[model samples]
Target: MTRVAVVGLGMMGLTHLNVYRSLSNVTIAAICDADADRLSGETTATGNVEGTADASVKSLPAEVRRCSDLNEVIGAADVDVVDICLPTHLHVRFGKQVLLAGQHLIVEKPLARNSTDADELAQAARSAKGLAFVGQCMRFWPGWAWLKDAVNDGRYGKVLAATFRRVVDHPKGAFYENGDLCGGALLDLHIHDTDFVHYLFGMPKSVNSFGYSKNTNEPDHVVTRYLYDHVPLVVAEGGWAMSDGFPFSMSYNLNFENATVDFDINREQSLRICEVGKPIEYPEVDAKMGYDLQLAYFIDCIEKQRKPETVTLENAADTIRIVEAEAESIKTGSAVSLG
Candidate 1:
């Protein structure tokens, strides 16, 4: 079995814990959280965008050790993988520690706050004996995964234009409210589409963005246009400025030479392909959420002693670079160029 240690018990961390509990080949060797109440099973279940929350009472299994310190979890010899689900800033610190300890590591998205920190972690992964990856889960999400395959394989001919959007009401907490820690909506919400764009279309030549910052300097609402030579139009908008009652939604429409792919999470049938002179069709997808598949794939990679292809540190760093460029464009009111 692939022994795993998860180092947080917040929404994302709890989501990871529940998924790991369900996988057959993976064992939850240990769980660590600074919140003493949470460690003592006094917290209520938190919901996630993916709808994977467990509303039942929270409790640790008999075999799983509860740890209050990160060092103790990292030093545990039985942990084959250290999944860092902490806040954005702590990723680099704990990520480096996990790698230097010769344990495989998986960190949540944005890799780091900026490309510089991300680059440091990437370099550490290169020199360390263990494998490392960022949890850019959209790459493995079923409908999104299908879209990626279609783009790579040229199933519907080259893409002509693509537009992506993610909008949600502001989260209720200090961690999400602080623009410094969570990077506001740009890093926290829009990075998903930014990373997905990079995964599907590679880095853009330039980025032009317009942002609306209500309470903080960070862009709570922003629209970015990615310039590409072949594809005439590629744009993404992400924000958390919607009213409190506004439901979270993510949708994408890709126009191709021969067909178009459309996906809206809030729709009845979320995924559909419309082709010239053909009926719209909904494709079958694996029922498992991206979180489940990603962790399962990581465990398989550990067992096989191989590197992950989908969410590598290099790709994640590039995504971070794109996001940073977007932020710059919003600040200076000019397009930023990328390598």
Candidate 2:
């Protein structure tokens, strides 16, 4: 069995633990967190997508280890994989630690806060003995995953125009209030769509973005148009600036030469296709959530001793670079040329 340790007891951390427990050949060897209460299961954290923690996750099994120090977890012989679910700022520091220890590493999305740190982390992953994978989970998400396949296989002919959107109420926590630490919604939230956009259609030639800030000086709501030569129109909008009661939304609309695909997380039929003189078709996807799918992929990669091609350090770094360009565009109120 592949032993795994998850650091951080936040929403994502707990989510990772749940996923790991459900897998066949994997075991949660340890859980690390600086917060004593979190480490001991006195308090719980939640995310926008999933609500309160499951009963099984409120506390781990007796055999599973718990520690407050990261070093101890990395040094443990029983641990073969360290999943870093800490804040964005801590990713680079702890990520390098796991790699240096020659243990498989899984760093949650955005890789790092900026290009400089991302580059540093990417280099460490390259030189490390163990394999590295970034948690760009959108690539594995059900509806979103189906969209990627359709784009590549051209089931409905070339994509004519595509628009993606994700929006939710601002998240709570002091860490979020500080723009530098979280990179605001543009980096923390919108990067999901940005990375997915890259996964579907390579990097764009240029990007024009518009943004609005509600809590901090940094942009919280962002709408970017990705310019490309082959595709006629491609745009994405994401933010966490909605009101308290606003429901979480992640949806997309794609117009292909002969068909159109529409996806909404809130809809009963999440993914639907339309074509002239034909009935709408709903495509079925894997029942697993993106988090579970991503972790499973990494476990398979580790077991096979194969490198992950789906989402790599370089690819994650490039996603940051693209988001940085979007931030610049938001500042200048003009299109930023990436080429």
Candidate 3:
């Protein structure tokens, strides 16, 4: 069995805890949150399988052992892996600790605040005997998996052009209100879509972007145009409409050489896939929590001694380079070339 410890019990942390409950081979050993009440409440409410359950909301049995300190959970004697749902900047720090403790590490996206930090963490992982994987969950999303398979099978014919949209209401405060972690939509939300674009087709040759920072200049939204070696890509945002004011969906369109693809990601189901021939239900094993698939894959990579499809240091840096270009374009209000 893979004994796991989850740190952070906020939005993403709680979600990770929920997913851990459903895994049979893996057991959630502990959960950490600064708030003792939060941890205890979640522990009792979720039945130790789910986090603090709110009758105000729905309920499920939680499996994680909740705590307040991150290290105490990850450093536990039986911990085989540490799944970090902490703030962005802390990814590298927590990752280093996990690796040093001889436990495999799984971090949520952006890897680190920037390419430089990501590189350093990558080096640490490389030197450590345990495996390290980033939580680029979109890669394992069943809809995307279907799309990639089809493209590789030649259904796309050559992959023409593709566009992505990810937006939500802007956040208030120091941006990294949680910690000195990575903040803003670019690193937080954009990384998923960017990872997709890069996976479907390698890195783009040039990137031009127009960006926006809420009250300050941190980039809450961006519209990026990328020039791929063989195709063109556009990743734009509707601005974060993450408030009660907006009724939204995270959807995208893919224009292939032979067919056009549209994905209507559902509220709680597999993404709807449509093409010229016929529409198909990709039958997503998970809708909201694809992290389970990701976690299992990473574990397979570690226990089986194989590298999973999550981003590598070079790949991560390359993605950030394009992201940086988008940031630049947003700043300059001009198109930036990729090369």
Candidate 4:
């Protein structure tokens, strides 16, 4: 069994802890959070294991350990992997400590603050034998995974273009509002779109993006144009600020030579395929607790000694490059070419 630790006590951090619980091979051996009370209380929270195993609406088993020091949980103990659910800026610092301690890392999106740090982490992992992988969970999303294969396998038939959109209400938390944290929707939010898009489309030749930021200190929405040879790419990104309705939403439209696949993780929870092979469908994901699959994938990667779909340092760097370019374009109002 692999020992696991949840490094933060926020929403996503709690989700990571729940995931560790559901997996038989992985154990929630330790949990560390700055908020000692929330960390300790989470052990008995009812909804901790509810959806994809996050919301419980029940009760937690006793005997769960809560630690206050990050170093004890990450460095001192025999934890096999440290799940860094901390904010984007903190990812690098914590990940470095984990790697230096000869432990593996599985962090949330936007692996580091900048491309240089992303590269350095990648190299550090190279020197550490126990180091396994780091990445976001979006690629493991079943609906998106199936469609990526369909397009790559020619089921989509000479795919011509693609579009992605994700929006959410403003994050009502101090961690999200921290200025020293990652920038705009570009870094924190759009990185998801950029990483997943890169996973599907490979590297883009150039990038052009324009957007405005909110006083809360991040772009609530953004439009990014990716240039790839002989392909059409336009990704519109949004998140958490357009909190007008009861539920936030995300949708994607994929144009292939013969058909189109429409997937809405928020609205419908199913993929609607048109013009070919009858309408394809996907299972609706529970938003509140759908993180189990992602955690499952991470455990699988650790077991298989393989890199995760969207969590590799390479993929992280690519996503960062797109975001960096987007910010540059926002400043210069000119398209930026990428290598």
Candidate 5:
């Protein structure tokens, strides 16, 4: 069995813990949280861009060690995998420690606050004895995963044009309010679509972006157009400027030579494929969500002594670069080129 230690008890961290518990060959050996109350099983309902938090607030098993110190969890003899679900800025620090300790690491998305920090973590992972992965879970998400398969297998011919969007009400919390910490909505919220775009089509040649900020200078609302030679129109918009009453939504429309695929979280049947002379068809995806699949895949890789092909440190770093470029474009009012 793969023994896992989840560091953090926030919404994402709790979600990870619950998902790991459901997997057959995995065990939640330890849980660490800076908040003593959370470690003791006190939790307040917190909502994220993913929607209402359904994670149980119950206490952990008696066999599972609860730690308030990160070092304690890291040094424990039974912990094999250290999953870092801390804030964006702390990722590199704790990620490097996990790698150097000879423990397999899985860090939540945005890998690091910036490309420079991401590079540092990548270097550590390269030299570490254990494998490293970033939790860019959208890649494993069922709808997006199906799109990737269709593209790779040429099931949709070639992508002609595509637009992706993610919008949600502004998150009211200390971590999110501080742009320097979370990189605001652009990095925290939008990076999902940005990374998915990079996964679908390689890095764009250039990006032209426009943004608007409310309380902070960081871009809470951004629309970016990616320039690619083959694909004529490729764009993605992400923002958190919606009012508190606005429901979170994520949708995508991809037009291919032979067909078009659409996915909207608001729809009852979220995924559909349309083709000429054929009725619209809804695609059935696995009941397990991205969090479950990502953890399961990482555990399997650890047990098999293989590398994760989907969300590697290298690609995660590249996604940071892309986001940085978008920020630059938003500042300069000109398209930024990517190497």
Candidate 6:
């Protein structure tokens, strides 16, 4: 069995805890957080997204150790994997500590606040004895994953154009309000689509962006066009600046040579396909939350002593680099060239 320790009992942390409880081959070796209440099972976390698998777990397992310090979690002999779900700024530091302790590492999205720090963690991961993976969940999401395979396998022929969107009500809490810490909605929320865009089609030659801020100097709502040589059109819009009571939604539209794939989280049939003479078709997908599948993937990699190719530390860093270009493009009011 793989023993796991999860640090930071925030929204993502609690999500991870619930998933770990559901996995048959995993054991919750420890749970760490700065908050003593969470460590002691007196507090619980609620995420922005609804329908998370078993978010009702408020108590830690009897066999699991609870700690209020990262050092303790890193030093524990029972822990074979360290999952870092801390805030954006704390990722590199705590992640490095996990690597230094020779534990397999899984860091949450937006691996670091900036590319510089992302590179540092990537270097550390490269030298660590254990494997490393980043939770870029969109690549594994049911509908999105289907799109990836369709685009790559040419089942729908070549991708001609695409549009992606993720918009939600502003998250509660001061941490999210601070642009420096959370990197605004563009980096914090929009990075999901940005990374997935890169995953489906390689890095773009440039990015043309327009954004406006609601919370800080950073862009709160941004629309970016990823310029590619072969793909005629690729645009993504994401933000959390919507008014209160606005529903959370993520959707995409892809045009291929032979068919069109449409996905919307709010729809009854979330994944749809349309060909020239065929009626609309809804494809069956694994339909599992990306969060759960990503961790399971990491465990499988660890068991086989293989590196993760789906989402790597370097690839996560590259996503941040792409976000940086988008930010720059927003600031300059022009398209920024990227290699």
For each candidate, what TM-score against the reference?
Answer: 0.96, 0.97, 0.84, 0.88, 0.97, 0.97
lDDT string for model 4 (1-339, tens) is 888877876667766776676689987767777775666664432221224325331244454467788877767566788888777777777788888887878777778888888887777877875654655667766677777778778865776878888876565556566535757666777777788788888878888887876735655567888888867655656555564443556678888888877887644545677766565655454443336677777787788887664457777777887778878887788999987
- Cα lDDT for residue 289, model 3? 39
lDDT of 5 by residue, 124-221 (tens): 99889999999898999889999888888987788899999999888777888888888878899899999999999999999999998874569999
Query: Could you give the C-alpha RMSD of every candidate to the true structure, in order shown?
Result: 1.4, 1.3, 4.5, 3.4, 1.4, 1.2
Top model by lDDT, which number?
Answer: 2
Per-residue lDDT for 337 in model 6? Answer: 90
Which ten-residue region of model 1 has the weakest summed lDDT? 48-57
Clashing residue pairs found in predicted model 1: none
Per-residue lDDT over 35-74 for candidate 1, one digit per residue giving the tens place of the 0 to 100 score? 8887767874465475665622256667788889999889
* Positional deviation of residue 66's Cα in model 5 after best superposition, in angstroms: 1.1
Looking at model 1, residue 171 earns an lDDT score of 76
Candidate 2 overall lDDT versus native: 0.90
Worst 10 residues of 4 by lDDT: 44-53
lDDT of each: 0.87, 0.90, 0.66, 0.70, 0.88, 0.89
Native-referenced Cα lDDT, model 3: 0.66
**lDDT at 332, model 5:** 97
Tens-digit lDDT track of model 3 for 1-339: 788777766555666666666667777676677867556653322211122222211132365455677757766887888888777778888889888988888777778888787888888988886788887767786667777787779865776767777655544434343323444677777777777777777777767777666533366666777776677545545345255334334567777766776675544553454556776545554343356677777767876887665656557666776677777777787777766
Worst lDDT 10-window in candidate 6: 51-60
Model 2: per-residue Cα lDDT over 1-339, one tens digit each:
999999988888888888887899999999999999888888878767743234244557888888899988986799999999999999999899999999999998879999899999999998899999999999999989888988999888999999999999988888888898999999999999999999999999999999988866688999999999989999999998898878889999999999988998888788899986799888775667798899999999999999999889999999999999999999999999999
Those runs of model 3 whose alpha carbons end farther than 4 Å from true positions after fitting are: 42-65, 170-181, 241-243, 266-289
